[model samples]
Target: MADYLDFVGDPGRDDVEGWLYPTDAHLMSVVNDLQVDRGFRGDVLEIGAYKGKSAILLGFFPEAGESLTVCDIFDSGAPVSDGNARENTAFYPGLLQTDFEKNYLRFHDRLPRVHVGPSEELGEIVAPGSCRLVHIDGGHTYEVARADMETARRALGPAGIVVVDDWSSAHIPGVAMALWERYLTGELIPLAFTKGKFYATWDPAGLTAGEVADAVATRPGIEASGTVRLGRYAAAGVTMTPGDWQRYNAGLRAVYSKLYADGGASAPQRVGF
Candidate 1:
């Protein structure tokens, strides 16, 4: 665990709430990539905003006019009738099992929308192509993740980035497996899975038939909510605002660069949420 944490960068950061909160490292990477690589400057859509940690990170990017939309099934929103649902409830009990209300209040006026409901439900509320980045941190089940991914895909802009949390993590092996199998065929590919979170991108021009066939061959009948093409302006690097760069040490960069090094379009298997 220590090695994993070290390899992924520190799990402890004052800016980030805690383990319960999504790490800023992933969002930081996304912001830097979008600004420098894709020239994207738009709203960020976060599917799950437990304690608003990850949303905070996205909120801090240099781009002006870029807002954030938060979606979550807070405080018993998900009915716990079956075994899996009960397990989910147990895992994230009673409003994120944290100070979600306080966190919600913390970002009350900061972001654009504080959507509360299931991913599918909230998906309808978001306008198509309104999101430049979709962060999926909702449910871990295959059905739920797939639905969330589809919604994010539809909501994202042409050169948008879709980030899926816990994609390559042991905490939810089923989600990771489903993501990998689907990725093999889709235009979306795994970018980075730092700190138990996985990032994927959509290139409107990148989708291919061969990849889809391969994905289908590996996992048959697994349908995606939607698919998009991979676009140009491909950019991946580590560039932070001067202040942020100084605050975060070189050790963090070394670790992140290594983690994101061989993490191109290939499916990852060693990630544990």
Candidate 2:
């Protein structure tokens, strides 16, 4: 209750522009807390921050000594290869770095170290094995996702965590292909799977993987993330708690209801979509 859930679970944060499934953030908070409880200290890294919804959630932790770094192309004309121009154009239209900074400053006084260019440049931007956790949510294409994963591999410290968003999403098979390659090669070990993210780590003995499942399984907002056989590895299947499901819908309804009651510009198509 003293962590990210209190902040991100607040309905007020919905005003921030971005997509972050509440459970993904919840799982992250629980696992990160466990790591911190076990006396691990390192920086945090995030790739492809849209407008700082997830970034602010990450900002909740990181004491004076610890740091957080965010990377995004953010209207910077970062090149897209393998026919991803269409994807970029459709997904991020008129996204500005200032917009993200504004949203972040709403929650925190100062911003994390921001990298406003190709995520591949993270190799030079962050020192090797300095990050306790890395979230890979940048490009969706195979090449870019692969490059981001490589950067994550290098950036993670001992018992570090890697979270790849949009893994196994149908629209972006390239993201799936990139992460799956790591799973197959036995480099990144699977810890948990969620609707919008894939959680893993380089813990070769499944120690961190089992700990992640055990940590979040009994947490308030997450379902029982029991261990399940995922290929050659044992991991957990993550989902929203029943309370979270109802709260999510109720939150949407409340937002739209207030919007229309105030005569907002957009018409209400569906109350909860």
Candidate 3:
């Protein structure tokens, strides 16, 4: 059996390459509470998986009979529309499902069920109310983010959590606007915000934002501000301490450095599908 520590330690560092912005420790703790501590049950879903970084973390908590579904465009060429999504996808040297699979398999024995296409098609592929957690990290464009959020709403089961990446980042203002619009209209309630992600929920009887903030406050090395209630829900901003940040970066660098020494390059290229 794969241990939680394995996914939280060197394997995680090697798989993510520091691309997961919320800090691995913070994400791990939240998922741990949701899965192990609270026993939230259902499959996991990620709309945007970049090299299986955060997707790998989502893979760790699925129990028997539950699968993790990852949706990404991969090598299918960028979206047709000319916007931030196209620009961002083009910026990457390459986007390949093979590289994501290789990184993911380094920790787990298998890959999640992959949907290699636009995230807008997610609702058609995945069953409604089947996911325990839905992560939206795909396209940064307003249209894409809005579509992903709607998909998340339809995909989540009772007690399920939805996390959107780059929600408050200045570079991705579209994501922030989309999320805020939903909140203002009472489509979703804010739970918490990390450096690069926003956590929300649609289940009123499920975990509350204040509860999430309280749990974060108890974790070591994380600094969470006092919760601020907004309408029916509450939210708090969280950040990792400087020492924890340094340690996390050091582990990531060590793994990549070793890979470089063995393979003549730090980063792995796409393997043939």
Candidate 4:
């Protein structure tokens, strides 16, 4: 986190900004920092790309040879027949409106390869053991998230980094819990856990999620409310067990409930396995 780089506007800045999609600042910071620090030489992938906000951020990295892949259904509300589609569109209506093709072309040469389909269908598109960084922002439901994580894991290389969003949101927690109960419990040590983000580095050595919980518990100012920056570009190590993840989730739920009771937003629906 020491060497921080300020984001500079690219040619497509204005056009990409007009879209309705919102990119996570923390994630943006993480990507930029990684590129600045790591100099992105490996492939980049994002599970849920809405109008390519993150894709654009990924493009900003000064990585010359890296290939960027974007996966999305691109149905818009037009095929909003299912309850899930309806709900998805309710939150994001411009899925179809935003000219993804044209908007993507804003990057012109840097435009990433867009995989048009569901996560499962698009999973195999990315070759196994080829990616250096994978961002999971696709379906919030558990099953979808789990599948997406599996796909990302397949594509991820030994030193690859996996970033999962909506850690605090209920809908996304299914994926969160599954990863915790499984890998976090067994090994796959957590590198960092932000307020609403879970970052785990793939390590052969089995590290428990409790180890991560312990790390968080000892952070300088985490006891205070709101998301605290646990680690900058530097990786923060954590370990946790199955029991630890459960207890952590319970504590998070309680905290979230209190926040909502005070008129704050409730956590998003957790992904269902």
Best by TM-score: 2
Could you tell me how far off, in angstroms, the CA of residue 86 lies in candidate 1 after the best superposition?
2.4
What does candidate 2's lDDT look like per residue over 51-115, in tens digits?
A: 88889888876856889999998888877674667877887788899999999898789999998
Which candidate leads the pack in lDDT?
A: 2
**Candidate 1 residue runs with Cα over 4 Å from true position:** 1-17, 20-33, 36-38, 62-64, 76-84, 96-98, 104-112, 204-273
- The collision pairs in model 3 are none
Using TM-score as the yardstick, the better of models 1 and 2 is 2
Model 1, residue 118: C-alpha shift (Å): 0.5
Q: What is the alpha-carbon lDDT for the whole of candidate 3?
A: 0.73
How far is 221's C-alpha from truth in model 4 (Å)?
Answer: 17
Give the lowest summed-lDDT range of ten residues in model 3: 264-273
Distance from true location, Cα of 215 in model 2, Å: 1.4
| Each prediction's whole-model lDDT (CA) | 0.54, 0.80, 0.73, 0.55
What TM-score, over all chains together, does every model reach? 0.62, 0.89, 0.82, 0.61
TM-score of 4: 0.61
Off by over 4 Å in 3: 1-15, 21-25, 246-273
The digit string of per-residue lDDT tens for model 1 on 114-167 reads 777677886567888877778788777777777787888789776666767776
